[model samples]
Structures are given as C-alpha cells and as structure tokens.
Target: MTTKANFPVTAGSIVVPYGHVIGNEKWRGSEIAQRLQGKIRLIFEDGLGLVDFHLSNRTCILYISEADLVAGDEFKRRLVRFRNARSLGGIVIVERTQISDQYFLAVQKLVVLELGMVLLPVANQGEASQLITQLVREQSKDHNSNPFLRKQCSQLAEPSLFRTVQQIPGVGKTKALLLLQQFGSIHRLCNASVKELELVVGQTVAQQIYSFLCS
Candidate 1:
C-alpha cells in the first residue's frame, strides 16, 4: 500500500507522507520515513521548498502534549543544551530531503558540532556537509578570495561595541536586550539614530541611547 507520503513524482524510495511529516506521532516513527523515501535527490533549501504541502490539524506537531512528548521534547532539549554548552555551536545538517533512521543514527555518532544544520530526514538526501567541505577545500586553492566557510572561529559573541554602550550613563539591561532584539546587534544599533531607538524603546530612552552610542 504505497501511501501519498511516497510521491512518485520525486523519485527514489523516499515516501514522505504529506501530513504525517509533522503531525502528532513519535519523532522515532517519522525518522524512518525521512530516510527511505527514495534514491539520492538534491534538495536545495533556497532552490526547493514545500510549495505543494499545506498544514493540517492532524499534524503531529499540533495535538501532542509535551507531558508525554518524549522523543520530540528530548531532541529539542538536547539541541538547546548543545547550543548553550560549548563555544563552538552544534552542526545541524538540515537536509532538503527527509532524513532516514540509519543516517540519523550515523549522525548521532559523528563528532557532532555544537551548532549544526538541519536535515529533511526524508527527501533529497545528499552528502551536504561533505559536499560543502569539498567545495571549501577546492576554493582554498585560490587563496585570494575569502574562504567560503571561514567564519571567525570565535565565540558567539555579544558585540564589543555593546561594552561601550553599557559604559554610557543610564543604559541598563532591559534597554540593552530590547535594543539588541530590535536592531539585531550593536553594530546595527551603532548606525541607528535617536529616532530609530525611540521607535523601538521610546523617545526618552532613544535620546539616551543616541547620546550614548553617538559618543
């Protein structure tokens, strides 16, 4: 009984059911579906997307209560801990295709980074990280252009400019958090005017922020 999950249109043994992908079932169950839907397909997050799929009430992400939501809860919690645990973030390999159980188990064993990408767990599964690294290595031959993956191998940091702002008179934690959220980071806020800060915080506070950052 080949279900709608297995869309023949895509290809391979990948059978990602339309609704069950997210509905209130165990993540363990879906893990299998994400992998064996088909042969290797290329699923680009920017190139390919869920244009055909629509949300449904019966979806697993909806009705399940976390009280008994063992698998899902645990996965998310571990991910959060992983993110906060070390300076180097986790490596989440989000696949364009659904992920399968075998691959997931293999990934769990890999030297998982603190900040990783997410995988589809079903369709268009490919050796993404390997491919990306391969590309990076290839690009390294030039040495002129910036390396494709050369992020400042530093901590996920609050901008040093914020250290300056905090030193300014009258600025406090509440205002800092609010300002950071609105403008994104200190570098952005540094460019903003008193009026923009006012729009986010208020006229009075904006004046303070402006006067502070301006200096």
Candidate 2:
C-alpha cells in the first residue's frame, strides 16, 4: 500500500487509498480522483493506518465496501480496536451500502456509539468530496476560533469538563452541566448513543449534538 510516486502535498491535501485510484467495481477508475486533483490534493498511502483516507488536519476515514463487511469478524475486531484507540478527534466512514445487520450493529456500537465516527453512505466521489469540504471548513472554524477566544481569556483558568461538553452543538452551559452530572464523565457522555442523548436533550438537539461531535 505504498503511496503513488510524485504525489504532491498542497492545500487541502488528503490521503486516499491506492486501490481507489486503480479502479474498482465501485470506484471505476482514476478519472474521479483526477477530476478532484485540481480542487483538492490527493496523496496515496500504504495500508498502515486503520483509516482508508486522512486529511491534513487529522480527519481520518474508513471506506467500507460491501465486500469488506461480508468478510466476517476480522473487520469487526479491527473496528473495535479503532474505536477504543481514540486516535483522531473527528473520523468518518464512507460506505457504498448501509452494510449487513451484524456490521451495521458493529458500526452503531463501535463507530457511532463507542468511537463517535461520522458515517457517510455516499454514491460517488463527488458526494465524498462535498463531505470532506464540509469537514475541513468546520475544522478550520474550530481552529480559528480557539486562539482568538484564548487571547480574550481574563486569566489562566483550570479546564472545566462542562465547558468542554458545551463545545458540542446544542449543548449550552446548562445542558453541559446536566450531561456531566448525569454521565459523570465526558467519556461516558460521548459513548452514549444518539437515542440516549435524545433522552437528555430531545430529538432534534440530540441529532445535532451527535452530528457535531461525530463530524
């Protein structure tokens, strides 16, 4: 899984699987990748990482094909490890199909519930590019806001878990405090499912909260 020769690192550089560039039943060929080369950078990488793709700012993703899902327990085991590693802040999964029930449950448990990874069932590279763009923009906004807000800090203060939880969308200071009290820790709160979050914050806000945290 070595990277392609002469791959350039540029603005919005994203590492993609070598297989996708070679043309698969689902991905067709390098044409899609070539089309995207102008707007975004694409680097090829060996299968060293748990994720299939990676962004410059640490967003990683696993593109799970239907065949990968049907391959049995190996994928599930890897997913379990990937979830618990908590290596990246925001990760994603791009799948052609929704996946089988067993794999779907695994995704619900490992990716969505345990690891909090964004799951995108995209039909083509164009849709994937859009999601990637949205992720980069959101990450940029978070990165840019932190420093400016830090400069306005009155003094160096101890970090509060409540404040951290409030960073998730729809979780204001009040809801953040409540979540901390209910869950007892940030880890537990993040591990809670969207359904569980709905119990705390209601349906609409819960979905938004999950999307913000996972994305």
Candidate 3:
C-alpha cells in the first residue's frame, strides 16, 4: 500500500557500479545472493523497501515466491503500488512451480498487459540468480553493442516505404515513384484527398488509391 517515496533510498540517486547488483538486506546469505556471489558483485543494503534487488539506477527487480502467489492478492498490490510510484523499471522475478503455474497467466496479464512491467518467471531462486547475472552483464555492455540498437541504427526506411506503397491495388513502381515524389512519405500519401492525389496519378487511379488506403 505504500508508495516508493516511503523507501529510504532514492532510485534516481542510487548508482549501481558496473557488474554489481544491490540486494535487499533480507536476501543476505540467501540462495539467490549465494548463487550470485561469483558471477556478479552483490552488495547488501537496508531500506530498499518493496524492491528486492537493484540491477541499475533505472531498473529494479521484485521477487515473488510461490508462497506469495498462494497467499493472495498482496503481491499484485505490491506490483501495482510500485508501478504507480514509477520509481524505476520493474522486472518481476516470480517463482513458477507446479503450484504457482495456475496463477501464471493472470499474473502475466496483470504485470505485462495491465501494468506494463516486465515479468520473468523462474523455477526458483537459483534460476533467478542466473537470470540476474545475465541482466547485469547486459546492463554493463555498451549501448552500441546491443543488437537491437545496431539494427535500428542501420535500417533505411526508404526500401520499406516503397514496398508498402506498392502493396496498394493497381500501384506499381512508376505510380509508387510518382506518389513518393509528390507526398514524400506514406503518412502524407494516406492522408491525401482524391483531388490532391489526382494531380499525380489521374482521377480514377486517385480514387482507387484513396479507397484502398482509407478502407
């Protein structure tokens, strides 16, 4: 029920050194902490409040045990409170054994769809530790080295734009070229009135294009 403001540590001000994870004092000597010892530096801290682990300044993890799932709606409320607080990007690490499997779909819908937070299910604390190690390593990597970022930066929009325009009924390379020259982009072309499109591709084709796009 409490907001992130109640936490003693400020997420914005907390700096997790590269390859290090700040863990809630409650996890001290626990399975996760013990498993993580050699893979990544684990620092125990007090007053993390609802957060179980801090992966970075902007990202944190919340662990949900099978017991928590069986106990009731308290875990859901905690997730909602953290989401409403918007203190950091929350990655929920939930224990998904046979018993907790029944609750998985509902929790997935609530965490990923309703609240828009990341949900990662693990068999137990040991698996959670492995996942945490990978996450920490990924965080330590340079932004440019990320495959997604590299792909986004390398992509050229022109090819896709031409392909999309050509998909319209009766539109070929020539008409597509004329449309691109006049409108410059698919967004502008889609919004063009029949009268406006007629200046480039004649009245009949213009109407067809308009109908195809609008319908």
TM per candidate? 0.26, 0.49, 0.64
- Estimate the TM-score for candidate 3: 0.64
Backbone clash total, candidate 2: 1
For all candidates in order, the CA lDDT equals: 0.35, 0.51, 0.74
Off by over 4 Å in 3: 1-8, 11-13, 150-215
TM-score of 2: 0.49
lDDT of 1 by residue, 56-81 (tens): 11110111112212344444454455
- lDDT (0-100) at residue 1 of candidate 3? 11
Better of 2 and 3 by TM-score: 3
Q: Could you tell me which 10 consecutive residues in candidate 2 have the lowest summed lDDT? A: 152-161
Best by TM-score: 3
Each candidate: RMSD? 17.2, 9.9, 12.5
What would the per-residue lDDT of candidate 2 be over residues 74-101, giving only the tens digit for each residue?
Answer: 6666666766664453344434554454
The TM-score of candidate 1 is 0.26
Candidate 2 or 1, higher lDDT = 2
Per-residue lDDT, model 3, residue 183, is 79
